[model samples]
Target: MALGTIFQHDTTDPLAVITAPSPNESPEEKAAREEREAEARGISDLIDEELRAERAVRKKEEGMVKILLLGQGESGKSTTLKNFRMRFARDKWIEERASWRAVILLNLVRSANTILHALSQEMDDEQFGLDDAFTFDDYYRRYRLRLSPLLQGVESNLKRLLGAQPEEIEPQKQTHPITLSPRTSPEFFVRSRTWRNFLQTTRGPEVSGCSLEQDLPDIIDSTEAIANCKDDIKTLWRNDIVQAMLAKRRIRLEDSASFFLDAIDRLSVRDYEPTDEDVLRARLRTLDIQEHELRVDDDADAPKWKIYDVGGSRTQRHAWLPYFDKVNAVIFLAPISCFDERLIEDSRVNRLEDSLILWRAICSSKLLSRTILILFLNKIDILEEKIRDGIMVNRFLPSYGHRPNETSEVVKYLRQKFKDTVRHCSPEPRTCHIYTTSVTDTKTTAVTLISVRDGVLRGYLKQADLF
Candidate 1:
């Protein structure tokens, strides 16, 4: 203050005095800086509010659905999954617009011993001990670590086959000559002599030692040699006979060992060869995996379902019950054509019992309450005239405590029975429908829908708004 006062000089104009203040002047300059800081803080607060609004809009774009399939073993669960995957993979909407992540194809069937052995060369300790009590999560984790590699192997083999060059088609090795045990029967010696004499007469002396006795020693050297030669001759003979009968192209085996090896190789090679069944299973698995992915992230894009391949195992079917609680619809498979005229008789009564058990199992499940059940009468392609006559149908009804023999009548009876079962099990009853499906040679003949009942269970589901 003393220094300031000493430096101060009187000025006539107030403006001049104000301008004359040193650059180091303090309190007034500090007040001006505080005003600028408050304005910057206001701008930052506005930015954060706008960011949250944008995120809310993004979250609204995503939706998800979960579905479960349940059935008995070998009821075409895998086939259904594969078909669904194929359909989805080829979908234009998903392909052109969506950010398609990789498909996670998990096969619960792999947990089954039959399928696991088929897919892998050897089983690990965990695989050997899989049980019905095992949960889907356990299988999913183990499959990721262990079974995924086997799938990669399958993919690699398929790629190699697809990329094979012309040079890869080498001529098959010829089968080693097989040595027959010395003819213990006199008839064999007589036949051999006659054949040898005939060959010598027509082809000259060079063919003299070409019989089994002479050629076997040169071809087979030890017990191992004979064992190896066995399959070679069998394969060569089978191929030759088949080609002759079919009068078509032939597959020649190089030798016996090769034939055995080729058989083993075929097991692996066939996995890469896509069939109708394979395509179906892939589609189904893809659908399940996609659904699981969507559920994990609630903010994912709405997923369109491609297929529903339900598990057919008794244990797996139990696991699938909860999934039905979330399903909007259902597809039921019935092999009506599997019924035979023979099944009508008392001697074949077990067939009817078995059929009833299967139907009861399906209808008794929790699915009856949650989804629209569509029954597919499969194998109609092989339906016989006797079955269509409805005699067998009538015979079966009495055993199940229902009226006998009218096809329409039987269907109505079963439908009512299922309805009652569902009502007893679920708090609410829903619409159930039936359709007769068949496979035919022509595409035009495939997938004929016989009938649909209007609002049968539709009203019930609508009233409840289960979804």
Candidate 2:
């Protein structure tokens, strides 16, 4: 009876009658039609399964908090992320502490080489008295020859650690693998996602192959190379002539993010491990967006956080849009200390001005309008240092208008400026938690982070009706 009904429906539909299979269709054609239908059904099932899985994961992560770290290059975004990892993901930070030894070694080498070059340039540029000229020339020739091997090895050592072969990658203007060497770049750029892997690889083996420290303690090969020239490094770094050259030429190595010159004695030993402060202070520039997940607490029900540290150079700003989706908050770091400094990318633009431009743009983005905005007027320590050194805020920013050039007053004034930018530029009403931070000072930053964590938890509680 069912078969007869099916035949009746097919015969009654005029369109079906015309579209029906040919009465003289071959067996091969019938098999092909059935095969095509089966394949189409299989594809549809696969897509449905993926959709279901994605939804399930999304539901599981309902309590997850997503925070994006945005700032200009050298504004301390990566440093801020390090603090989060140190506090929330303590075990991982400890595990990776040894890996940072190589980077620190590289930083020290870079500082030495920078002085070497600066001394060379000073000798070439200046026609000092006979005694002064003789002293500089001797210093230049002796240290340059001694540090020459390190100069040669640093580039190769850095490349091997980054997992890039000479033939595979080429350095170009406005691109990745920006040399950590000061001669080429003031900031070191690395692939963010695999940041620790390369550093870990180079930790103990490549610099001095067959060293037992690789297996025992993870002391990097750069340690041995650096150890060989430790005295020369110390002498040159502390030399009156070198300091004079740096000061007069305005090559302030002390002002750079990778300033490890102060800790040469502690850092130059084999089996050396980076202290938490050392790790926090280390310089490793991020090239692309890096995602790190941390369990904010030690409970089964603890909220997981997905922190995104995006690259902050002008060219990298376009990559930030996709991450603005579903973001819970943003921590925008504006380095107020850089008021008198200019950007590495564009010399015409002051660093503090670039930071302000970035802050305003972030404030005005409609996508981020509803998200929590935390403004870190970071590097307060540097600001205070500059202020005490008689650097006037009014000199760079006439709008500062002769405010008392004290740290507290400067911070207060800049905080108002940042707050005003958000007030005027945000697409809608929002709350911005502004903090004067010196992120490298982990002790103080810990207190700041506690407030940040508490606020995020409160929001989650309210959402779950448990507050």
Candidate 3:
């Protein structure tokens, strides 16, 4: 204040006052003052830059639509999101394919383990009356011979990524052990930072062998070993002992490791590349929500698409509310085939009933009243197969009374049920864009995706009064 008053009130030459430094000020003090001024300028520039960036993001979001994939666990939400990437951002998908190799191998190993466990169950349980034909020693010997190498390879891969097995990697106790079958239990995902680091840093080791015998030695040897023992697998599947056990337990072999059993010969091949269907059928549960951004083009005006793949389990639903307000649309996946299945979180609730309750709550929520809703009645393929196998709908869904158990009739009935639920519960009456989707089928899903995109765009435009 004293310096300011002298400058303002004193009768001094203007040029002398402006050009002269204070007489008592040392060179060091002047230098420090300059340094402080420069830092202040830098901070001011940074703030301006951040403000510009914020504006750009806001502008981009104004033109972009954010889609949230929602469903109960195993309802194919992630698979649907993967299909979007496969269609729109193919280059990125190809780049990530190498990482998926480990996941595919893990899937194969888990399948083999499951089959061994089922066989073990048969030998241990007297209720199945299967002890006379199948002994643990014989089955165990066959498993060790045919599957041990692959299991070892899986272990090696896991060790490289995690330095620990899947069970040892942050193992958690089951929340609903009674309701969930071990088969339906949540499986591991290759989403850890350690896995990413391994994939990025490591390289495959070289091998020396004959061309015929060791083609693709870098491709895990267990893969070749499994391929070589296809005959043994088929024999195990067709064994009279297994057949008797199946009949006694009425075990639906078609549902679990049956896919691997059927395709052992093809999957075991050294050159095998996973198709879109193979990736979809791979059963790693979503542990957390994943976000992917796609830019349609490099043009300034090209719209950005932000797609969120949310975890759909009961426990994971709590994380969903934070995302609801800003979402432009929701692609709700409901598996029509899960009518006979029970939820892994709570066994008392049938899977289909759980889906209905979830759908109703979503439809009725005021926060999402303006959001476009596209209902994917997914897994129709599985539903058709189940119906074909004489799985009576009324046995599990008593309300589906006296309905024809044929695929077409059952699908139609299920569709109407969803339609009715939406009509009754939706806060703002709106038409639900429903599709009977087999998300595993690429062609069908692509077509449905186009339709959904158009529907969501139209809804958004209408909301903005720009349509």
Candidate 4:
């Protein structure tokens, strides 16, 4: 009876139609949306607080920890920095903390190149004409122009002497008359009384025409005669031109040396080709390398970090020694294929050797008395063959006793050798750890972490309270 009444009341009414909620529009969906919004807000607050706390901690750790990277030129220092930046971008710990400061990357090679380029520019700007041939008059003119400043007083005196004695002037033809007699005296035909007086005054008693008791007026004529001979005497002083040229040369040499030395002092020196343009280009390119400080807060109550990146270059190794004094940990980067035959054939082993030298140098530095070393075996993709084939062997041996074949055995040998080497450098052997990493990948590139002596690294970091 109830069903019949309902059908009769709204058989054709639109309100009588019943619909159910779609699967996506249920209460569960709304609850999930609310939960996500709450979680997002919570994360945002957490991140903001963490960043604030990290900044506060870093403020106290400024200039505390300095880490350096050292290797040969073109040994992937720039690539490593880029990879590090990418890691920071992807890592939740770095992203949430927002504690990184600016990254400062300096290239010594580029700096030296810049100074050389500037010198070249200065050389090009000099007024010295391109043509090699020069007339005597042109040479004399250049000599005078260059020496004008140095002989400014002498020039002024000469000008004043010529200006004060108006009576000494004569017709140009008379003053420089063409003489047939090679040894004729310039005063022979001085008929004017003034000229005669000038000759006597200049020639004095020692001259043939002058007497010991000659009066002042008679001596004036001799002075005129001597003045007439002044041009011949002036020709003898042209040797000063050589002095002026030497002065210019000295100036150029001194300026170039000073410029180069200043550049070296600022950026340090690195090896490279000697092409003029290559030097310039390298210097101009250095402006793009950036430097950054990495700070990490391990515990809320612990001290912060002021991390430094030493960059990669053999010369930069010396720079690392100073940083070790203040650092708690050292991240030593080693190429995965550094020990591989192909890498050696490609001459990349030279770079690895340079890196090892840096490590050895640091171990010997007094500043690193207690610093921990963490070896990062980068570019592990190429190392897979050696690891799988069990063909890895120790290439560096001191006693020359045993040859290693298996990868693990080779690694152990290396560890022992490195440990012994460090012991020689320090009273106590500093702890070291190893890790495998691959920074790049492509269709042709396959990288994997074959093996890592993580215990050694963990132990060091733990001892230093840096993990």
**Candidate whose lDDT is highest:** 2
TM-score of each: 0.35, 0.84, 0.79, 0.35
Tens digits of per-residue lDDT for model 2 on 1-467? 56335444467678877656665678999898789879999999999999999999898667788899999987899899999999999876776777676667766766776677677667776757788988877756888899886677764475446555455233333453323322323544567656655545444454334433443332356667777887888787778877776766666563442457777778877657789988887777657778889887777787899999998888999999999987888999999998988777777888888998889999999998778888899999898889888988999988999779899998888899899999999999878899999999999999999898888767656656788
Off by over 4 Å in 1: 1-62, 82-88, 91-303, 306-308, 338-368, 383-426, 439-467
Give the true-structure RMSD of model 3.
Answer: 6.5
Q: For model 1, how does the per-residue alpha-carbon lDDT over 140-180 read when each residue is reduced to its tens digit?
A: 34433443443333322222222323332221122742221
Estimate every model's Cα lDDT from 0 to 1. 0.36, 0.77, 0.70, 0.39
Tell me which of candidates 1 and 3 scores higher on lDDT: 3
Stretches > 4 Å off in candidate 4: 1-59, 62-65, 71-290, 295-304, 340-352, 385-406, 439-467
As a whole number from 0 to 100, the lDDT of residue 67 in candidate 4 is: 44
Candidate 1 overall Cα lDDT vs. reference?
A: 0.36
Model 4 — TM-score against the truth? 0.35
Q: Give the distance in Å from residue 92's predicted Cα in candidate 1 to where it truly belongs.
A: 11
Task: Please report how far candidate 4 places residue 418 from its true position, in Å.
Answer: 2.0
Residue lDDT tens for model 4, 1-467: 57436444454555553322233466887687678879999999999999999998666655344444434433334344434333322242222111110000012211222222232333444545444124333454443444333222222222222232323222113554332111111111112243223323333344435542333232233233323333332342334543343334322121112233333322211221122211211211121123444323334443333335453533333444455555666656666354532221223444445555655776776766776666655555545545675543445323424664555454555556556666677656666655554444411111111122234334445656678
Ranking by lDDT: 2, 3, 4, 1
